[model samples]
Target: MMDLLRSLLFVLLFYPGTLLYVLTVIIVSPIGDAPVQAVVHAWSQFHHWLVRNVLGIRIVWDGAIPDGPFLIAVKHQSMMEAVDTLHFAQCPVVVMKRELTVIPLFGWVTRRYGVIGVDREAGASALRTMMAEARAAVSGGRPVIIFPEGTRVPYGTSPPLRPGFAGLYRALGLPVVPVAHDVGRLWHRGFVKRSGTVHFKVGDVIPPGLKRDDVESRVHAAINALTP
Candidate 1:
């Protein structure tokens, strides 16, 4: 119950600030002066700070960003993990569910920035679309982030990752950075509250020159190798 109350309090502060940010995005992105992508990316960073502060999550930066464009396959623990990426990476155009675009202002913001949507039910067509987007993002000097598990899994328990992850790595042909961490305990589910540090450890990058068609097994192995 205390966590719920805290979350509500946080929401109160966040909503008003978010509204202001949304308005700024509208003003800046519409005019010719500011590039839409840069403005939105800035907003994402600020938004990350807002949530981190409200939730009392102190983000510790460790490791280095790969020298070239790469693919970032991260373990999804909570919504915070998704938001935190904006701070560390301007690259890694995130791959997310298509339905997120349906959200009001936030959806518009994500689209204007760097998120790529994939329809879960579209099967082969979705795979094709993901390949194209992932490849383009990597080729254009942005790392592409894929949640191999497809959805957020609470801490300590593993969710079986989807098979498409391998295909994405193969199709993109870039270094793969495997990110893993336990953030679920920080942002617990249901009607309670707790606050703590969330450590996101970014592991080594898988370099190019692997068998092109063998993307699936390689992606699965690398993700599994990430220490919990």
Candidate 2:
């Protein structure tokens, strides 16, 4: 089928393209953050091009992308939004699992690029470290993005957020911006991606200093507003 062929081509092109981009990042990393950031932007743009032309998918933004530093809690449905975040935000500090930050060359590049890796199994220690890094990122005027649900879930399913979200919320004391999207409908955890529009709906900003239960409930609801 056309979808299968397109998917195959996409994989073939994406991996090699990513390798080149990674290498570029590694090379420019020593120069300064600006050069590295430029490479990352180009890489994200490349992904957008492939998704639109090769996979026949379109990304539709429903609301304005935030410009200032804030805690961005996004709904994680698939890898599409993971990469797309680079395109939507201006020099965002993404919080990802420590495992991802340990990958060979990619890991080093990620650390150099300012990604905050979270050790999920490290319990309270991990939260402390993540909060520390998030504070630094916010002070630098870069938005910190995290998947509140911790991991990707199937379409139409909304899970409770991980505990670290509230801890980070309290520590950073920054307003939270919830982003809702339906990427799994066309780009689930497999090959042969379907062609359609992936809607990215940005919810209103939630101010800081609310009760843990209240903030969690509001973010959970906002991020899943477009789920069903």
In terms of lDDT, the best-performing candidate is: 2
Model 1 residue pairs with clashes: 3-192, 3-193, 92-143, 166-216
**Candidate 2's C-alpha lDDT?**
0.90
Give each model a TM-score: 0.84, 0.97
For candidate 2, report its TM-score.
0.97
Number of backbone collisions per candidate, in order?
A: 4, 0
Cα lDDT tens digits for candidate 2, 1-228: 898999999999998999999999988888999999899889888988999999999888888767887899999988888888876788999998899899998888788889999998999999999999999999998999999999889999998999999999999998999999998999888877998888888999999999999999999999999988
> Over 4 Å off in model 2, which ranges?
none
- Tell me the deviation in Å of residue 126 in model 1: 0.7
C-alpha root-mean-square deviation, each candidate:
2.9, 0.9
Q: Model 2, residue 182: displacement in angstroms?
A: 0.6
